[model samples]
Target chain A: MIEVVFFLVFFLFIFPFAISYVLASGKERLNIDLNYTRNPRYFSVSFREKLFKAIIKDSLLKGDSRIEVQMSKKELVKYGKFNDLTFNLYPNHIYVITNRAFRIKKGTAVKKEIYALYDLVIEDDCFIRAVACDGVCKIGNDVIIVRWIDAIKSLYIGSGCSLGIACSTEGILKLGKNNIFTRLYGHPIITYGFNEKEYKEFSTIIEKTIRENPVQLEGFEDKPVYVKGDIFSDDDIRLKNVIVEGTVFSFKNIYLENVIVGSPERRVSVIGERITFGRGVKIYGYIQANTKCGKVS
Target chain B: MAMGGIMILVLKGYIISVSLLCILYALRHLIFAYDRFMGKQKIFYGDIIDDQLPTVSVLVPMHNEEKVASNILSLLSKTDYPKNKYEVIPINDHSEDKTKEIIDEFAKRYDFIKPLHRYGGKRGKPAGLNDALKIAQGEIVLIFDADYLPPKGIVRELAVNFKDPLVGAVMGRVIPVNADKNLLTKLLDLERCGGYQVNQQSRYNLNLIPQYGGTVGGFRRDIVLETGGFNENVLAEDTELTYRMYVSGYKVVYANRAECWEEAPENWNVRARQVKRWSRGHNQVMFKYFFKVLKSPHLTFFQKFDGLLLLMVYLIPFLLLLGLFDFLILFFLGDINFIAPVYVMLIPLLFSGFGNFAPFYEIAVGAVIDGLEKRVRLLPFLIFNFVFYSIYISLGFWQAILDSIKGKKEIHWDKTERFRDKGAAD
Candidate 1:
């Protein structure tokens, strides 16, 4: 009786399972052949094995890859490398990503949304709007960044990477060995990082560096900007429908027309010469100028 | 006494012929399987030398096509063919409506728009095409139905295939623009997807004969004129043209990338009329080209076999209906013995099997390849389609065959009615 049951089970069960495995393997091979020119990381599992696996509660045949992980900030702090992973970053999400090493220093809240698909290494004391690193990236301290959509942003070595500008990447970004960043301004990226000895090989990369105080151009999307105090700059100061709380100084041209300076008792003054104002340019101050720039209509 | 012998002889021939057709139907599924799984992927050529592209003339045959004429003309004006090289000829086939007016307006606006108005002709698409053939100045003549919205690059894509000297004609793919209009249109959409995307594309990928649909396909002008142009008597001039081209050692290439969107019939009544007309026309083509397809030397043996099966696709329903008629005769003759041979018992099952599930298999395979497995759930309703086709398609096929034999005088080209969404005409 035992021998008969064994024989029946072997023929009816084990034999079919073995045959199915072979056929499923053949199907897997065919899938590989069809998608060989595409990304090999993606797999197309045929429906037969998938159906059978569903019937037998076999999760192995169904994919264990492509994990959808949701972790708390405390849990993420203890984690490292991820492969074929999509994360649900909810509370306490400090967005720092590296290839195999990702770290967010304590007390630095994340600013921008982080969607990582590349290998990245980010240090603490940073604010990133959004960064999608497709290649090796090393980011250091005291940086505030915004996200931009690109296919491959290869390598970034920003230590005090503050007020950085966008990079001109032709699909690949090659950086030199000693390419450390003190502060970067509204200038585009300069790839091919320099060696330590060849740091003086290049004259200038950044357009302007603001270290003393923050240059705020806030709420550009929804609201017009309002400055509260006196502005001192050696650049062209163009204003439209703006109220100045105090006097301006040394501007190349005071392009102000319908100016609304301080309170009626404490009206401020504009201290520059050249000014060409449109119909609604306003500053709540007085105009103390050497000469106006354009002819008034 | 001799009448009985003759009856027996007739019955024997019937069984053999019906069995042979059933086997052919089975073989069609086999080919569909091979195509769905094993056929090469269809390739599109994006880089073609502009200077080497031939000058082409496009013909749009219209009969009371006022609603669609403006849209079609607008689309044709935007086609990516070289401006000076291609001319649009809208053949206004004696319409009592504003089709001619629309074409005239277009011709007035665009210098390349040339209108061909036919006052009196044979009153069919083939006849309109024949009239337009005279004034078409290009080396190649492409045709589009009045309702098609050919994409910008479709014309260029179809024209590039003609760069191969051996290619005498080319056919492009079609998707339904109003596929979601109704259940009937939705089913028809899936069927069209199966027929074109899966079947025709696979046939092209396998180096088999891909059919030249009357519209969205072009042929060499001189070659078509040499083959005596479109036959006005044949309802399916496309099939007849396919045979003529193949017989003369020329290939009809299937351009899978050259896709155009067309409207499918939205109602069941309209869908029935459309399918019946298709069946009748296809049967006429089958009867006309049955032997010519067999004798074509340009085709491989497999191609010849596949072509013959394709030719007889419309007549399969009739054969199935006849199989039932044979069973009835047998039942009356007291041959309904349960103790008969297993093969004899399985005959009805075979016919019903083909009638019931062959189309489902085709649709399922097509849905799989097209990533439309979600729609495969709707396939159980094919029984209703089977019953309807077995009756109506069989009637249409027989009528077409008898009409050919008896030389029926009046063959009307029944046009499918259009449902226009004025806002979405663009």
Candidate 2:
């Protein structure tokens, strides 16, 4: 019985001590080392290569192609034959468009083709006259177009879109399908410092515009052209040499000239050489425009 | 008839062995309780101060202590001690983070705040302390860790004890700041109260040498330097030094009034690391100094006897293991009668439960009430103080035993986590 008791005590107490002694000695002699290599450019290139392949696979499986208008490549290709087919290519490729505007009228059978050049992807689609492009533009499905677009990189236009006159866009212009632009005006010429009678006539016209559509004018040094309608533009709208009698809501900048803003009671006119509007505008109220301040008889 | 007699003898032997263990543990509880509580002997404030105040260099050794470094610096900045009489030296031991930056910023702000940075990896805590000790300009050097926030009059209180020519070192009471942080901290707080308030005081009352804890302790700078500062090789240099001081016939005094608050580990893993390190270090001290303690002609017979008994206390776990072995043997031998006196073990169990854990519970509850009255967040940690911490201490005993055999003398300073609570500095 005593022997059994001693053995149990030895197992519980002494054995642990013996084991720890051995492990501790072993731990003391162990060493660790690490290596560092400096090659950031190579690392980034390899990382990008992997990322590019993943993006392509993801785009193909789940990409929506509803709004993209197919363009005829028969005139573009050397063989001059039209084909409606999708093509696959390597990851490193760039796509560029030579011309800004190419018209795709109604009942036109357009050819769809893809071009790849050194890490850039370009899609050939039906174009419009006087289009704008800027930056790296990504076109989504169901893009609507109501005006001409000016861009830096790519312009993705939606299908079945009508163009308004004197409309322009800069940078990348992406449009949703079936968008409409009702009225667009070219530069207007108006003389400054008009009499009160001329200001009253201009004020009536501006008030009439504000009563119509929702419009917002911003970044005007003088009182802005109160637009009751929406204006969509691809870039900044410079309002120089322009008079807005109605609500002008533009996606681009609005440049103003020596113009008069008219209200129902009176007309306010200012002589300004240049004023600009950013992004777009939406107005829910009244607007008026005049060339010179004058009394309305 | 002879076999029956032999069976009776075996049964009797088992009962006797079990009863003896029960009696010993019961006695240990009584002594531990009496020493911790009733045995506390303190010198009145008026009786200690008799001479000119000595210049005190408070050496604060820090490593990766950026979080609480500001609080410690601010606390030291508010000390009531004479501005010129004391200097605060914060030794940064090769911290990889913003610890040095914070220390430098504080040093620029306060004239009394001096910062020292070490570039090489830690040689050990003792090595860091020794490095700080080399440049300490005060007559008395006080050691405080990064977590310790000494009370306003602490330096004055600790310094007063130095008037006694025979006193080589003075150890102050270290109270846990976040006593109610969790069960682990509460248990640690209780153990400290039992140890410092009860055991240490009792030893002081009995005129025996109480062990010096590493922090919140002060020593005569010259005496410490003469004794070779602190031995970097030993695990528990404080315990080793305490033994050496006693053998050299120097009196080590316990200053219970000089209080400092320090944070205790809130979890079992940290508590285990701390306790294992402490126990292993104490064991190493015991091994290194046991012979010298016996051979020293300066120590009286009673002091030598007390030292030896303290040495034997480390072996108590082994004795408990033996008792368990006897219980197992009696069960397997098909002798039901032999295990009859197993109830005897319950006596010590009950005593420790009531004497140690119950008092610990009372103190924890009181600390919580105080914290609540003071509107402190530490009140919440009082709930699980016993369940988590008691298990950790048991684990520590096993780890200590293992560490002792391995001759693992490397100094691993397991730094305590600090909270951002501004009220804790108060």
Candidate 3:
């Protein structure tokens, strides 16, 4: 009985503990790299730029001034592969590197990713998988983007478009009416039918009223009316003619009329479940809406 | 006979209370694990692209940190945060080594690199930071220990959270740079993964208090100043700052994607000192802010509950230590009842006992989430860490109690020993 008990203890407790200690004593360690690089938003643009540079530098290339070098299957097979970037792309994946403007024809179905280095314009009723442009990008009406669309410069989308996962731009994003999008990132996003003339008189009147008779909100700092701290409210927040130096957050809805949030030197954010912008609302930073974001007529 | 009966009752009560505390902690860990594994993740502001980023001052507190000062400074100099908008302030607090020379060299090279040399006054990190805060010119202040190596995008990732207005501070994830050094570093890496990836993220997701870790995190300068800067007396100024932010109606956000690397203690002695110091500092903050959190009108019910529980975490181990003695007394007296229903509660209690600060299953879950499944084999080894922590943490608890009894005001800050050579950083 003693021998049997010793064997049981040896197998169950002693063995596992001994193995762990030995492993700890040894020079073995888990593979955890500290320097991990993440892909930037303009990853495709940078990748294409690098590839173009490599191709131009290659002594094997027969052409000197070939801006639009269409690689044959054999050339594609022998292309210089660098890092994770492979030339094993599908036939549908188009690489357009040009100094001049390019246009995707009307009703074109872009089944794979497109990396364009020049100004890009897509015609009406097009279906795109993903597209990244180094310059300005203009999309026509009824276009459907299945994955993502990114542009380095001003991006304009016509009415009745369907933007899939995300539509981001380094510059301004002008989104037309009746567009469907999951996420958008831009500096000063403008929607369709945003007419300055429509609410000019109403905005002037509201601004005058706010300046004359200012009402106090609970979460905001009192006096002088210039908000130094961020404005946060659990309920709907309505601001008129207030210059805010910080971010504004409302859990419910936000209505802004002639309110200037942040400055060129200091950028802030305004976020809410739903947001309605009145005339003369100038935001110098990020803006996000969970449900719906629009401008009042 | 009456005395015997009273003693038995007391023993039973103590056991029951300890068991319940164990259960509560286990439940908390389980909830955090589940929330991280399956629940909808709360998105951080790292994805937001803004050209007009806030002016930031990156503060690096140093004391005889000549070994790793230049590495962090080099990394900070190359950060993606606009050089014109941000500045690096390396606080050299009474370092009687080559630290000053190294910092001065960098200061001369980079215009944005400003070195703050504190030759006198209090010598702790909090005291050093107070001096830096006075000269800081940015709207946002990011703190980094001299040993840490922050990534290029960490500044941008942490700074964007300030746009929330409600967020007073933002904490990033910390990975051990020398995790593969030894068993101790490996274990520390696992603990860190569980702590940040699951515990902190879950707190952020549930709208509870996400702690603002001193390093690899940034906070609004005005908010800290308005709340009377870092308390020079408090050792765990980070935990104190966390509670202060919460009570003052400001929030601290956690960014899981914003990862930085730091060297973990390679030896047991250094690890013990680090734990004891953390425990002492954390317990001090607990005593300081326990009532303040309860009375705060800004916190929700869940926030208050979580905050209180977090404050009492260090004290629980000491209580559990006492409960062990209580259990022995009851067992010797033959007054203990080994009933069937008790076994059901004891299972979870057993799991909680094995992994004290971080439960075994919670660490396993964290490893799985972090794609480090191979490290799960090391879960059994944490039993040793649990015992080690229980002893040292209990000692720290006793130290805190003694300090409270004597109304001790003086602070002694012991910096963790850096194992990284100056050449190793390259």
Candidate 4:
């Protein structure tokens, strides 16, 4: 028993040390592989030549496309440049690539906000409305508007789209290109679902409207829409003057009044006043419109 | 019947000896736990509110340390302390390579750096330090080896503790930076943590003067000169000076917070050389001053006892070995039974487990977490650290015994290899 104890004690201290020593020595031999060295002189020459030729080619193809601007504290502006370029703003810089290909290296931080206006080859074609804004704002690539009808913030109206009177979108609003609306009469508010409880009391008014004119909401059935109260993404997305919201996956010619339209998945909601449909509405979720009919007979 | 009785007596003696060793090992663990884990050692960065910030001279003694010399200079330049209040005096003790050239480049770039080139190869680090001490203009002299990369706030931290007039020396914690590089570095890191975190902290808490580690230590320039600078003849100048400071009625305090990272030996060959030097130096100091410490008029009885204990710590591994051998004899004779006292093994096992594995795991986890969180690439190396370290430390112990037995007392300065960008201004 004593011998066993002795052996254990000896092995405990000595064995670990011996193994470590051998491993360390072996590692020393292996560490040579970690040292990476290329022919620096040859590589440098080739790199410099390639860089010079690329710069010359870029300048010949594009006009002097460099934009320089100074930005003060909290200043925001939009640029409409379509060339390979660099912009050195005060305290920060923004670069836009409108030609061939550009790569933003990983592990590098660009300390400025950038808005890519046009779809270059690398970036996908999508309407980026209010890409950088923190205030009540309206942004569009098309259409002009008059005052008092309600300026829209948080509503993303894409190219060649128009909004009618008495319509207001407050929460996250994403619109696809060439979608038009005719005379939206009430505030269509979209908000987070958790905060929907506070607005649920007001939802009784909507319920009452549906009960009173149940026949008017016929064509609004099964349309994809979002309720104002759902945890959209990670954060609770809330909007005022827009109680309910939904996404229209397929394009439809429609008109209706004071009703909520939602998707089958219940992920999107649309609340509007007096929506009309020119053709048959193929809906996905719950939709409530003022009146549903095949024709006005 | 008489012959059987004689055999039984011998067997019983062997069993008793083994039992005593096991008990001692167990007790050592208990003391280690009480001292290291539950010990009331505060590791906070103290305030440096004093109006007068004294100029500090960082003396780096180098011998063929070309590899790491550039890195040391670069790190020194980036120190968060005021540039005007500090000067780096890198004493190049006849480096055979481009160490002088590297120091010269740094001197040209930074006015605070002065390269003190010694022509002939010095026998050891003390000679180089002594040469640099002549022109050292700082009120406080901080010593760092070529391989050390002191953290930004270290100088200020060490400076704040010197407010106590009676304090002769302040020892900073030296940690292994390349701990994940291999098993050897990992073990060295653990050993360092145990020494700096546990042993040194315990001694400091108990108000006992702990030995100042060579690197990551500071001393009052006046006080160092008063004691005739460093003893060049002694193998371990740091240990010898620490004892001398105690004899002069000055306090040696260990600052657990002020940290500097050092490179551990990458290979066993370098590890063996470094360990042999440390062992020989420690032995020399013990032999030279153990009795002197006891008889000194300045030392208290408690201090004398502590010093003696400190000196005897070097012998623990050897004693443990002997104790194991003595236990083995009785076990083979069948005088002692294992089942009766199974709990005895638990004590040493538990103690050794914590003492060995805790620091290793802590450092490995720390490296991994830091790497994952902070994006430092050295995190993956933690896995192999344990196996590498055990080898280095065990070899160190073996080398210590071998050197002592062979009377190899030559002061050979083993230089660590550096892995920083050479062309950089640092």
Candidate 5:
């Protein structure tokens, strides 16, 4: 009886496998690689033929008119001119929270802290792209950048610039000699980005930190979460219904009383190391520190 | 009792087959969720830095869009793409209201906003796009539904993806502008987050096939025309384009930066009809592309595998329907014991119900990544989304199959009933 049951289970399992094997064309027999970020497009044909099929035919050969590559910043601006349009990160003006000028770059590096693009105006409906160090950001002919990052009142880039690369988006950027590139047709891209090596270091640091100092949050529920005396949390602090009145810091995320700043009729003030309000919570003063919110006055 | 036992034994084989398929589907989503978590923060804003921006034709297919036409036209006019390089073609697909009048006014106001009125022709977005392509002079054809409001620089952002010699088509993320309107839109906000933020973004990050969603995306006019414009008969011309582009050895780039706002259906019935139409269109594309995807040498093994899974996405509900039949048969025969948890889970019902929660992980991850936990707390309500999808998608699948077998001409493209005219909820 046990043998018959085993046979039934085995047959049932194999039935699906058999069908899948046949239907899948079996060409994808490679072991499943968990590393998703490392994929290179593989063409079935030769490079020459594939290039002709992809670039020449798709682009319609208008790109053949290429001038000699020059490294001067003048050449950069001369090639790609910026249009007069501008994006606003802040409602009325752009703000800079950084103690130093924020520089954007491409490549990977180990860093203590970094951020995705913040405090910059982007009125455009847009998202950021992942650009490798060797890659070029091609702002097509007649295409132009909106005058500036809307939030960053002082942000300026002469060439079409790549924003902080995808891999590293936190802390102070530290670019190495090998991280620089010159053949691109955009703003000379700058800023130290994170790669696999930096990512490994980050994983180790985060793991070690979490292990050494475990978080405790049982007491901060339901009641007003007025963060005081330099509150630091790696995770989000979810609170509701009451007012919050203290300085709080979180390395990851924080969800607090949603401060809805609709129509910049009145300036509301709140001090946040790095904060984002939920929605609808009223505010009375202007935010004093570097802050990011869903809606603000 | 003997006869009942015989019936259970006979049906067990089919049930086992269906169960394994469910497991496969669940496993596929598991990988997607994990990938999304590892890299949900990544976005793709396409960039182009050249002096000569290619001529682009922005195609807006409208049906009774009088209420929203002017707003969208104004937004398009504001885009920073060189005015001379791009033209706006707003095709008025036989609207009963004053949509034509509004579009004509815009056409008169801006030399670029040329309005095309379709009187007596095949009705549907694909049909309209095909007709407009003949008159469109741009090298690239960018499409936006009448409801979409694209931000400044979106045109150039998408056009930049073509800088990569291989990119034949490009797609961008879609954000629901009226996401905070109602419960339906709120949940749809989560759905869209998972669909675009996690699903599409991760697919692009992994260099896998990121689908070219119809709106906020564009294709090389020459390539699309050379290969025959949008398939008028195919409901999901976007899905068809993704498959056809892949099979034809051209790549589709997903631009994270080209984010555009769109209005999602605000009510359950509208949402249900919208999902039904999608499922039906997707299933037809699947049937057409299944073999072609498998045989395409340009696609890597994993790409082919991913494509196959995509083809089966619409069929999940049908499999659940079959499982329901199995349960009914078992219940009528008084062999209820045949559907023990172990057997039932492996069969078709497993993923459709429990495995449906896979998207929850993505939505939660998306919410966490975006720092929107309030919505994450509302994750349980996704069961409503699942229930609606399972029922309607199954009906759509069966209906599409029946239509195909009967040689139905399939002309009317049902538009999702708009709720934009109605004020948003408080």
Candidate 6:
């Protein structure tokens, strides 16, 4: 009886583990892709840019008078989507590259990555996929971009436009009121009613005054407060009229006005939950906000 | 009578001490499992896209790595990072194989591929890195073992963290390339999952010290150079660097998404040697930095606590081994009345459950989180691995103690054997 009891106990203890061991799956090999790389081209703009460049290169080599290459529906269909009614590509489509200035009609449900050498304009309520323009890009009100836009020159976005994941310009990015965007990059990202000419004039004047007097800004009686090291805070950070040479990290919200983070020679980072930048804030580095980031008064 | 009483008291004290250590470690694993399952994950800076990226120097230290050298080199040369912005430096550290020839061939082909041939030097990973660091032109230095295959975006993902001045170093997730090769590799793959997916990520979420494993990670050039390059004597320069950064008021961030594939040891002999080396080097670091961690003003209370626990991880196995002997001695002597002596048997089960140096629950949670359902069935097999680990760890621990007694300053480096065929390279 004792021997039987011992055997039963041992069996009970070892049965589940043994069964699991036998029936267990051994497909634990991880797939490693050698050529796997995230596309550096935001929204596949490089694809359109390369296509444009290739066409131009071929035209120049052939000495063609007219530098234009048009693909028919058959050719375009190979790339992707097609609109049967309009006989033009739309909705989840591929590339549309052209050298001349182009305009999209109002309320057009356009869905293709476009690259234009000259000016590109979109009328009100037109939905886009992605666009890259060498010249100025004028986006209409209520425009919705599904991906991104890159304008080598000025980019003016109209009011109530949902400006996709990213919108960048080498020149100024002028945004209208209630324009929603996750990321915006430009020389100066300005809001509605802020004229570019006036903004440039105001900025030049401020630069001249700063160069000449180096005067202390308002609410800062202590002149020329320069921080040589990083500023880390576990709480909310509010800085005004200060120059930080290194990164600024705040566990909570950050409010900055008239603050310069890093010089052109050295770039730093600003990390916070919600960052609000007032006027005259110049940053030479990266800015990351967990929740929301905006420009206030 | 008095002598026996003293012996019993000492034995009981040892038992209690071991029990407390097990509980502390078990609780730590429980906390890690719970946090991993429920806590809000802290996001890394991989998604932040910017055009103005910093220059980087990728260092691949090779010691007879001819079998896998070309594989890493070819993959690195084709990365998405601007070719001009990053340079791949493959350090040929006293290779007796065709590693030098292979690296030189790459150098001749690509301008960015600079080969550092170290024929006459103290031949080790640290020594090779020290040589490379002297001539590396980039602001950031990314290191990779010859066996590791980094994705194209890994450089950008790692380099982006340096934008934050407080970030001294960044670590990436390591997955085993040969996970399906054998049972040993499969177990290693699971451990990797638990360590990175659960252990390292939870530490980062809680703002604790996340270890920078030497490969698949990068650090600011100046920060490490300022403190003198990696110590050549330390076998585990990665652990040493991790602690050095933390103790010196710099932070190490873990990029869980920057996953890189590495070839784990395919056989038990290789695994034993690898684990033994880790135990030896890690315990050496423990002895070296245990007091420094306690006194570091940069570390918060919890950071110090976790740092100490991390430092003593290698020594835990040794203690558990001693605890087993203690329990057996008590049982044989007919003195099993001290605080429910049968509980001592659960020490191994409690401490090394379902994971490698992690409790079973943590590994299970990690597998669940990683969506690796079938792999969880192999949890019971880990008991055999625990016994294997305990013996080697105890040996390494004793070796460290002996090294301290002899005041040993330097130890010879033994590289892990590679299983990849020469034809595997592109």
Best by TM-score: 3
lDDT per residue, candidate 2, B8-60, as tens digits?
57765755665565455445445655554444333322122122357988888
Please name the candidate that would achieve the greatest DockQ relative to the true structure: 6
- Model 1 bad stretches (over 4 Å): A1-297, B1-17, B42-51, B339-358, B408-410
- Local accuracy of candidate 1 as per-residue lDDT tens digits, A31-108: 101111211011111211232233234223443322222332221221224443233354334232333444444224
Where is model 2 more than 4 Å wrong at Cα?
A: A1-297, B1-47, B312-314, B335-344, B347-351, B354-411, B419-426
Off by over 4 Å in 6: A1-15, A18-173, A176-188, A192-251, A256-271, A277-288, A291-297, B43-55, B82-85, B222-228, B337-342, B354-356, B423-426
TM-score of chain B of 2: 0.80
**Residue lDDT tens for model 6, A1-297:** 445555764567598777876776557555656555544234435545555564556545765423444433311212212223221533443444344666777887755566656788888998877777888999998898887887888888887787776677766667666666555566545554432111111111122102111122233523435565556655677766666666666656677766666655664556666666665566654555653343333
Tens-place lDDT per residue, model 2, A185-242, is 1111112222232321222213332311222333233334433222223233334222
The candidate, 4 or 5, that scores higher on TM-score is 5
Give the worst 10-residue stretch by lDDT in candidate 3 chain B: B340-349
User: Please, what are the lDDT tens digits per residue for candidate 4 over residues A28-89?
Assistant: 11011111221112222332244334434543355444443333343323233433333334
Candidates 2 and 5: which is better by DockQ?
A: 5
Candidate 3, true inter-chain contacts retained: 0.10
Judge the docking of candidate 4 as incorrect, acceptable, medium or high. Answer: incorrect
Most accurate candidate by lDDT: 6
Clashes of each: 18, 85, 0, 53, 54, 2
Model 1: docking quality category = incorrect
- Residues B320-399 of candidate 5 have per-residue lDDT tens digits of 66776886687676666633545644453356333543366767766776666555555655655666788898988987
Candidates sorted on lDDT, descending:
6, 3, 1, 5, 4, 2
TM-score, candidate number 1: 0.58
Error of 6 at B345 (Å): 3.8
